[model samples]
Target: MTKKNVDDYLQEGMYGTRLPKEAERKHFLGTLRERVILALTIGEVMSDRGLEKLETEMKKHPNSTLLMNGSVAYKFLKQERDLADKYKISHTTISNQEHQTEIGAVLTYDHAIDKEDIYLSNDEDQEKSDSVEKDDQKDQGIVERIKSWFS
Candidate 1:
């Protein structure tokens, strides 16, 4: 390896170590895409869709860490955090003030696993969205019943 130059030292000191795929890392909550097992968007996190799949992934990748976007409210991310605690998986909520990430949560290992796709499939997303819709409908029904009683 070549000797460190003054410029390199200054750069490293000011910005920390230079890493490839910085943009991707920022998007994936300080992890690489290849290292991610599963990733969820803010919408999915709020709706809590495919959480069972997330749990399954967690069980499968025991060493994986759960990285949640700090931008999201803790209330929305609480369930996933609880799951991580239940399974004894290490997890952290990361935030990059300079960039806004749409992803709400990620299941990832320290090293690259190099999986082709990390996001949930359309079928799973659709199924979960459908379930959320049904739940909303049920809550609406109960509200209607209460309203009728009051009237």
Candidate 2:
């Protein structure tokens, strides 16, 4: 049976529309969580008590990155959400703007299959390099012959 994971989630507004596999969803969630955690943890001057409490609270929500009801946490979440949206990491969701009280920014990543548009072919590159090397070797041989004649 398909596990009830992020795919089961109803992403409203601006979020990933493509239904990601469970593994992909988990990976995306993990990345987003890490970003959120970093945001919540770094570059803040707080009392030892507050810092300890924050750490404890973070442990409580391993899957999440926000400290509950923290404006700073929300700020970081918003930043991360914006970046996610910009990069098409997830589908657009109204909750992207709204502060997440529980999970802290439910990221429904945009799981669009990306198509690589490479201009240069590897074979063509290899052929060009080979031709250049052959020309260089011929030139070197010609130079050596001229040097021998002079000698």
Candidate 3:
């Protein structure tokens, strides 16, 4: 049999498998929103206070994900294996264009969503909510408002 082409798979509904459904897309976006604010706050805290401060903060909570530079994480792990092992802290190295040395606790997506106010600053949350409200207002046209009024 001949090899199936892109069009053949598209016709068979095999393509776009990675695309999320409407509800899934909304959930994913909300999760990302929480993670972004958490990460940003953590980064700022870490930068201002250093890794030791971050460690002290993380010690308050169990199973919080910690992000650090690869080299720093390696050295820290080698030097403090006992502490790391005791806390069961997961060490993750993020490599990106931004030059930063970050080490702080992170909440899971679900936890962040449930505790968004705790994770995100008031200003950040207000900004995001305001933008969302604007988009919603834009979505509701005059016709839709009139229909709602009658109903």
Those runs of model 1 whose alpha carbons end farther than 4 Å from true positions after fitting are 1-10, 123-151
Ranking by lDDT: 1, 3, 2
Candidate 3 residue runs with Cα over 4 Å from true position: 1-37, 41-46, 49-57, 68-86, 96-113, 118-151
lDDT of 1 at 143: 99
What is the alpha-carbon lDDT of model 3 when measured against the actual structure?
0.45
Report the lDDT tens digits of candidate 1 across residue range 1-151: 9999999999999989989999999899999898889999999999998588899998898888999999999999999999999999999989889999999999999898898768876657687899999999999999999999999
Best of the two (2, 3) by lDDT:
3
Model 3: weakest 10-residue lDDT segment is 24-33
RMSD of each: 9.4, 17.4, 15.1
- After best superposition, candidate 2 residue 149: deviation in angstroms? 1.4
TM-scores, all candidates, are 0.73, 0.28, 0.33
**Model 2, span 1-151: residue lDDT tens:** 9765654565623464555354433333323322332222223312111233334433443443232223334554455444444443432222223322223223221223232321123334677999999999999999999999999
lDDT of 3 by residue, 1-151 (tens): 9898888788668534444343432332222334322332434443442334334545765565544334333444342334445678664544433333233333333344344443434545687899999888877876698899999
Q: Given candidate 2, what's the lDDT at residue 62?
A: 40
